[model samples]
Target: MAKKVAHADYHGPSGGWGSVRALGAILRREGNAGSTALALRRQNKHGGFMCVSCAWAKPSPPHVFEFCENGAKATAWDLTSERIDPAFLQRHSVTELEALPDHDLEQAGRLTEPMRWNPVTDRYEPVAWEEAFRHIGQELKALSPDSVVFYASGRPSNEAAYMYQLLARLYGTNNLPDSSNMCHESTSVALPKSLGVPVGTVTLEDFEKADCILIFGQNTASNSPRMLHQLDEAARRGVPIINFNPLRERGLERFINPQNPAQMVATGSKRIASEDHRLRAGGDMAAMVGICRLLLDWDEEARQRGEAPLLDWAFIRAHTHGFEAFADAVRRHDWAAIERRSGLTRGALEGVARHYAAARNTLGIYGMGLTQHRMGVETVQMLVSLLLLRGNIGRAGAGICPVRGHSNVQGQRAVWITEKPELVPLHRLGEMFGFDPPRKKGLDSVEAAGKVISGEVRAVFQLGGNLVRSLPERRLLEPAWRRLRMTVMVTTKLNRSHLVHGEIAYLLPCLSRIEIDRQASGPQTVSMEDSTSCIHASRGIREPASPHLRSEPAIIAGIAKAALPSNPRLDWNAWVGNYDLVRQAIAATYPEWYADYSRRMWEPGGFHRANPAREREWRTETGRANFVAPESLEADPDVRIADGEVLNLITVRSNDQFNTTIYGYDDRFRGIHGSRDVVMMNPEDMQRLGLQATDRVTLIAAVQDGVHRDVQDLQVVPFELPAGCAAGYYPECNPLLPLWHHAKESHVPAAKSIPVRVVRQA
Candidate 1:
């Protein structure tokens, strides 16, 4: 039977009444409409909880309603009065729960207590907190230190993340991998090599002063709606916003600020992007090189005419390195190859370059589209190279902004939840904690999964994320996960990860970000670092979902205390009882960035961490920003099809989804409703394949892995995509993404581009 799919060309603006209605719908659905106004008003405000959505920066004096529709949804999702107690678990077996859809599993409601898998009954049974911790500790003690993987999500507060990593290190291993490895690890890896900073150099204020904004491969509307406000304001100020992505997203084209009463009532919208270039999937590198090539050509022409050079020659000569080699590489890039790969004409790229050259200061903003490809690191470096051509870096209102996903994903890294051993200050940590931390580098997400599959990793510890669902190769990982000796998950809500249990799996319910965390010291406040490097306080105003739920810090502390009973130097109890102690320890460990952390967090807009690149103080090996050239113009060189007909598949997140968590089945902005199992193909590609809207098809991954990686029963919908390219929602289509198909250095799954052949389903 054909799935019930709703299709229409959405003519409304990005936000406005649509967003208002969506927010109301979510609130009503969650049965939290009574406290909606209070919860929303406090979101993103000083002394209130941070929006658990994207890592977009909060203004110093935030708006009256500082939250977006998605942010509100997240709040409502967390604050839902629904509960998943012992009876709920008793009603559903693990196997039966595993069969449920991802959305249905989460929608069952928030977990109320710690539960342990009872293999005898195939259901999770309520377990005492102490007993659960003791068993988890025993399981860890039985395994080798390197056999356990401590994984963290982006949801944890700075204190929780710090303690989580500390717990891993105390357990005598450096095997700490977190959500960043999957999302923006490319940026974290590439930025330091190019700009001497892992994070972006720009602040929220930079958007106000930017003359030109270049957005690459990011759907600002769906991924981070708060960013739309910044883009809308920039557009209103006549800033030339150029967007480069396969889809001409409504958020980039136009937005109606729901906060603006007049605009909402009038049903009027403001133009966002001055130009939207629909590039092919995984073509960011080629498009960027083309723009750089044009800029260099213009500079050469200007120099020949005895006019002022278009490039920032003085800045390049003083503050950067490898300009000659980078320029030579750009000049040698074939224009035809660039055009073919980017699916853009020379004239179009030249126009964008012209706008870039005309602007004194430009902000380069990108998302997973540029970071989840095989050449993600090189692509990010190429963007840095583009900014280097005009001295965009280290200048006011100009820099590379990798819009991060989670509110505290950047914070987790800042507090040292990394697989790289050298990134953390081991010597300082030892002095502070009186324990010799592990020096060996650990496995990233991909390596960790491989280890799990190989039976090398016996246990997995997750901090608030659906690791199994978020990762690629769900088929391989999920079964391998069940074979593990132990799996511990500290989360607020029920997810697929809980159902896919190990031999001795434990589900530890923890307090959500919006709940009051009353510790021995009093009602505690957790701090999170925004994408802009501003560390601020997030105080939960709502009541806890259940009395049994503990704060993330408390859960981590309990586990660490049970695991490392003799470690007297590290006061796990003190840290949990008083979060200020965690901040003090964090301040001591990384004094350069977090000194006086607690006091600074209370500042009007929080405190911005010191980014050496912003001051032109290069921390690279060469002591300067490096213009690294990519080896090839193709972002995914291995993405080829030797078969009859193939399309480059780009996995996307719908407006109703956040990472692996599905809020609803509707993608309103794209006009997709009542279904997520659909592939969006270009009109010409659909015709070429003899397919039409709602035509059922199966996408077979074009790989040499011998294993069949395919997603069947995907309905086709015609979209304005480039030829030979199709888009599908992520995780649903994640089966087509092989575990081996990841970025070269960063190991981030190349989910943005997959070579696949589509066969119409009869």
Candidate 2:
């Protein structure tokens, strides 16, 4: 087998001509230059389909080219000319396809029709949509509702997600787990506990007014490129940007705005971060605590001098509770302990604290880096608690921003897509839907995988996303998925999950977001909520890749009708015909929040979902903002390595990849090319471990319990990372992450902070 030539170079800056070249390459490969151009123009624009990329909020007055390089790639990928027809499926066996790469499977192009697994032949044969749904219905009905798990990806529109969750609920199961469980479930759990809201309080316009913004554990350029424009503007306007992460990201260093004519012409690129602190993988919580401790000591000194206090005493007294306890805890945090845990000197943290204290309005930004840890929820709360000390929430230009990845992930949660029945009371949901929803608890992603492995889960159905590629401990999870009685995947393209067959497997082709979705009434439009909670409609402008492909809503509704023939209370078919009716039902479900959802969705810039916390009105048990005061912050207590080199393995997404989907093997931002099978470590650590760059090494999981797994043939790359911390690409390195190693409160797998031992492969 021939592999693409791998290359490495020192990555410097972001955007400029590089972005243009990347976009051009994708468009040329797509071969629909004209249509791809139009799709790119319409993306993130008013009345246009939302970009199937990151959840970055569209500006009120959208830019001429609102899409980024990766966003353009996503659009082109969805609108590719290649198609997986019946002949293609007939030629390839499931076992043969399973051995191929993730990119290869998706590159085979959009699925044209429904496919069913043939055990006798071991190939996926074309099946009618009706027949496929009927078979799934039969399998689902044969088992208990609790025995089936319905997993959803983050790419679906609000209408589709709401309908899918409703279908599961109507079928008497609350086992609704989503991509959020794997990524930012920490934010979804932590924020509401302290700030009375799960979503971020900052608006898109907050960037302009902020004096300083802290970028923690997120590569803004690769993950959310459109944010480079905002970061460039902030840097140019003299706003100090502070970055805290284990690795030195090129985006955090400097960025040239591709939209800027001057920068594109090689005038110069603006530096993004004024101060960059390379904190260890699990050191974020300790770093935050160190900053808080300094702030409190400074406040006490200011009070003794009869000068104005640094703390917002008035706001604290009026709007916050438990400040005294929190302050006491901060004062008690030992500088030595904080320094040891954070891998930063006390003076360095104090210097950063001074800058934090000087800024009138500061925005704290983070991503999966902070959330994919054992102390993820607590880490988020510490940042929130820091903001509360200065009365940042509800204020102009200052608040918390988790920086979600999916387009409608936040919206899906708002509409109630979770396993917990208490989130939205069953009685209230029953009154709106006219059917009593199941009250029993449901399994999360990890627990669901465990059930599947235990042979307790009879069936597993995925709306989107690659379960085999996204979940942790794939070596175990994949075999468990194979043992299922039935497996169904509703997707636009073939992925690794499609190859993992059960006793009975079905693949239902669905229309991509860039494709036209026509139903019984007329062409339909779906809505998605961005990171800022702005709800808008997404109407595909181009013709669909395949005529046989059905829209996601239509497929979900079809499955609902087939699965629940006895209950005629909900008209699933009629509702699917007109998505407006779905929105109307959503409005009826949450009359107070979504009173006129259908009308509001069509508004020019869309409408912002009402959040009382954003307006300074706390809805907690105390009827005010709460503060959590912990004694210490430590992530992994079981990481004991006395002999070999122990590295804190942090899983990261490559520049060309989005979650589990691999666009290409090149990660331009990190200087890694044509390969993700490598580990990045600090030069000092590499020297200490007697390893050289490009040396083959095997990474063994250093877990206290559970099955230990090892990833071999990983090339070592000495990059500018913190000592004792090594970075590896996700899905491949997911096997090293123990399933049981997760956050206590949120139950999110600790993908970012896996303790591992690195040794040269013999």
Candidate 3:
């Protein structure tokens, strides 16, 4: 047996938000100048245009000295002076590494070699690339493609994701689940049904000219620091920016623009929000419905007063249908009912209404905070409705902005992986990969994870992802991974997913986007679309850390060769060697924007795909933007509302994090120092429980099944959030979210809303 060390949570020496700042300073202390420069250069060259972390950033790119405290940490940690080689693996067994903390293992360094888990030594051992490929092919060949699930992380390049999806479908399965499936699957699934497209309706420029901005679920200050500039610009223009969330986030509350030298010197910053509304989590859809109800009610009152109506009759008549039913639903629900559900008084709700009538143009921006609940799909629809009432969607400076979470999550989804589409624009995907398209819908992320855990899934080939930690329900996925016949990961760094040892597990290190790719043909450039739907070319700026790292495209090509050695259906080498050929295939099939991908991506800002829907040109069967009115604006399971317990436990990301991966321990804006153990609870809840700011508590998730999934202790911090609501760190609080507890339509975990009971620790 091996002795283990307790996991350290860095609570500042004084205990509180001060510790977070020192943690940030300590993180910068680690020498990372070289990698930092390279990473910064990538952002400048490629990253300068749009953030790779969250949404389509509208502000000008940050300069060398312009990094936010959190962005500085995200970049710094990625460029750290550490390396994980086979030697590290030799020193530690698989069991031992699995026991190590996620941050501790990553802090060791970037993985430097291809590794395989050895049963004999119970450790991971290095193997030649050829041997690993051969073993992978054999295992894949033995299983049916339908039985295998391919989980993709957003970190992979567009070309890599394109190739990975192609490989999975060609190998005979469309079990393609990704990070988007967990976060924005609601937007992906519901947007097309309502808006005739799966992406956001607004472009980046919309943020600049909008008279009013209603931001929901997203903590812009923490997640996409660059976007704060847009809010600052909006404020300067006197635009009323309204924010809604359970916790009163520091970012949305007030942002001190680090870019403003005068402000920084004065120790004062720009205010992003003119007014903020802290609505209970899972109450967003209802609050939005209240706004709609107010609009409709005002229109009715105007008719009685012989005054002008609140709705844009011209736009509504020309662009939409179901207005009758939509208006009917809004009319049925009044201010009192909506106010009761939303936790905002009728007066406050009217304030939101007054802002709507006052602003000629408005922009609505949302994040997973809105899309990760049971009403995720409905919430997205309500926002669409909110925009449509004033006729915001088709116009400039007013539209719906679904802030995508990963650097290129939205971009990748555009390039390939069209799961639920009528036509699928598959000509390009088909001709490029040289395989007949599998005319079938496949399992989504939650569905795939459920299938895997239930022994229905025999194998999994995740392209650049950490599923065990990346997804919800560790209790489910951990055991499911062990039962896998084979598990293969194509990655740039070693992570928790690498340790989910199967009957046969292999970790194939791949090239990062920042590294040079030298193939037999020549150096290659891959294109990725930004959240705003602008595409750009990304070529490596630095050499690979080691010669062993293969590009994701090359790995997919190799896997294709091994999987279909004698298949006449595919020419794996042709697509792999000359990426241009793949681009040509894309052009031949999907000519919307990628008709000449090489030429288009070469342009400075890349090409914007034609958005016919931008002009209210719906591509749906009806050829008009349609309305989807839910029977009830209310959704989500009945959260256990104890006398002193919290109802909605929404999960959120900090500045030092991107989704599941932790970059560091500092969340500067949130006043969270050194550790992620603190949970943000309403001050009223604290009083009810006799808790203070730093009171530690044991949180047992109120699951319906009576199963204490991943119940753990979390420190309680009294925040200015609304009563009955609380916020906690993700992947830590992820266990509290059940695998089965996802959105009704999207199947994404309801991380935004969970029932919880807290007790002061003994």
Candidate 4:
């Protein structure tokens, strides 16, 4: 069916009556108006489940209604009365269901029972939980441990994530490919290299104290709606908020607090961005270079005038190293190249740089827009260097805030869920788990895809996430998945990934965070860390969508016991019975921040994980923060475009979307209503290419690879974006990104900056 497109006036401000109306529509559609409302009120509250929508840290002593519009949608979708039982599966064959859209597949509702793919009939039939585990166990026991890859998403709780990784390690493989590899792995890789820590140093409290907040490549109002409240507060306080992005997002321009009745009914909304810089796609590095170059000049000029300099010289000299080399490289950068690459006038960039120089305390916040590019790591490091110039790292209301995507992605890594064995304190983990940890580095998501294609990987297991939709190069990934001997998905709802099965496949239904998990130890609560390092408890209040569903930890335990029956060290039943035992194991493995995990969790707002970088303590090899010099500003050397009508493409999430999970076919904030198959382009670029708004066009990738990749019949909409830059929804456009195209250091797929040519459909 053709996806409908209805254009609505762009949502004036992020929130207000519009949000209230949307929330109502979602609840009514779910047919559980009363239950959904109660669930939403409980979200992010004391003794309530953390929102599974976005990882925005809940405010300390959260508000009465702490949820956002998107959170309400997710809650309604999760707590829907609809259920996918054996009868439903029997009616819909795997081949038939595979033809449905992602939204339809999930809207078919939550999976209620364990199902095994019947190759003979090409259907999924109900299988006993034990039999499903036995099949997975049989496959793993037959294949070499290294041949099995375990994929995880960021949505799972800390307890579930820890158990998932521990099971993989105990099963003798480091092949843990996670969602971070596709999203914020660049932040993880770059921060540690520059600031001596993988995580951001800033806390939510910093939002209040910051004199200025510089936002890069993130639409906070839509992605993290609760953050709009913070942004609104910052704007009302007259703080200078600067934004850098290719497209002018409404969320960055202004926001209306739905919680504030006076503001909602009185003044409409508060102006957000003091200045918005429209940098070209893949131009963040050049822009950062330009800002730093101007800052360096300002510092020199201030010194010549016998005035206090903008640079924090004392902090630089005492706590940082290699400043001269980095500053020299900044000086050597050609202004003409920076202007051309960044698509910004030198005067405009310098104007913003001066504002940055004036702020005593600044907060640098960024998202996937900056991290999903070719030089993502370099761009992140440049951001760190810019902050370090003013000693922003170790002060109140000042630090790098790489706003994370998933609920507990940071906590997942906090408990060590990475593929790199060296990053883990192996001896300590081994001591806790009573086994020798794997020494070899494992494949990330992209690499794992390649291995699957090459027949090197025989078995696949996913904890939580839509691997096929989330990963790049779906054309190649489809065939690779089919080649696997066995595939297992532990998921709560139906998704496209469930249809892409191997010869032997199992779908194990797991409980969602909004659903109660009554294990042998009674009702249990799972812990999750937010974007900021604050850790808190999440206890589901509502009953499960289905009685057949099991807790994620319990499911993992069952699989682990079945897979490694002879491994006497693991007491799966004992650990799964009581979640506190799981937290105890986590604390024992990493004694640093998690010491007394259970005791400290009861603290008012949950405790902040210890971060030495917050105190100006550089834990780098040289015991000081290092400033690395960037050789150039170009992000993608592999991109080649024809002269006629090629443009840089960035696959973005619509306001109605979250990490490959589509809530609806509407992006109200962007004026795109009831449509997911639309391309956003600058009007000038559309004119140059002989295209008009609503014109049906085919987007073909401009790469040398022989494999063809194109998404056909996309509605073209002229938007206020930089010329030569086009934006489209992700997963739909993910095919344009090849498997080999990724960031240099972090190996994250370059989904944001793809080069493509436009062809008008006849």
| Per-prediction TM-score to the true structure, in the order listed | 0.99, 0.98, 0.93, 0.98
Q: Which candidate tops TM-score?
A: 1
Ranking by lDDT: 1, 4, 2, 3
User: Each candidate's lDDT (Cα)?
Assistant: 0.90, 0.85, 0.73, 0.87
Q: Which ten residues in a row have the lowest lDDT in candidate 4?
A: 1-10
- Worst lDDT run of 10 residues, candidate 3, spans 1-10
| Best-performing candidate as measured by lDDT | 1
Give the poorly placed runs of model 1, Cα more than 4 Å off. 641-644
lDDT of 1 by residue, 1-762 (tens): 436788888878898888888988888888768886688899999999999988899998898899887888888888887889999889989888888889988887899999999999999999999999998888888899999999999999999999999999988898999999998999999999998889999999899999999999889999889989899999999999999999868756778898898898887799998999999998889899999988888889899999999999999999999998998898888999999989999999989989999999999999999999989999999999999999999989998899999889999999999989899999999987788889999989989998988889999999988888888887888899999999999988888888887899999999988889999999999999999999989998988889999999999988987888576667788888899999999999989999998999999899999999999999998999999976688888888744548899999998898888899999998999999989999999888789999889999998877788889998888888898899999878887889889999999999999999999988
Model with the higher TM-score, candidate 2 or 3: 2
Any idea what lDDT model 4 has? 0.87
> For each predicted model, how many residue pairs clash, with residues at least 3 apart or on different chains?
0, 0, 8, 0
> Clashing pairs in model 4?
none
Off by over 4 Å in 2: 1-7, 566-568, 641-644, 704-706
Candidate 1: 10-residue stretch with minimal lDDT: 636-645
> Model 3: residues >4 Å from true position, as ranges?
1-30, 38-52, 58-72, 418-423, 426-434, 567-570, 640-646
lDDT of 1 at 274: 92
Every model: Cα RMSD to truth: 1.0, 1.5, 3.8, 1.2
Residue 399 shift from truth in candidate 4, angstroms? 0.4
Clash pairs (backbone) in predicted model 1: none
Error in Å for residue 519 of model 2: 1.4
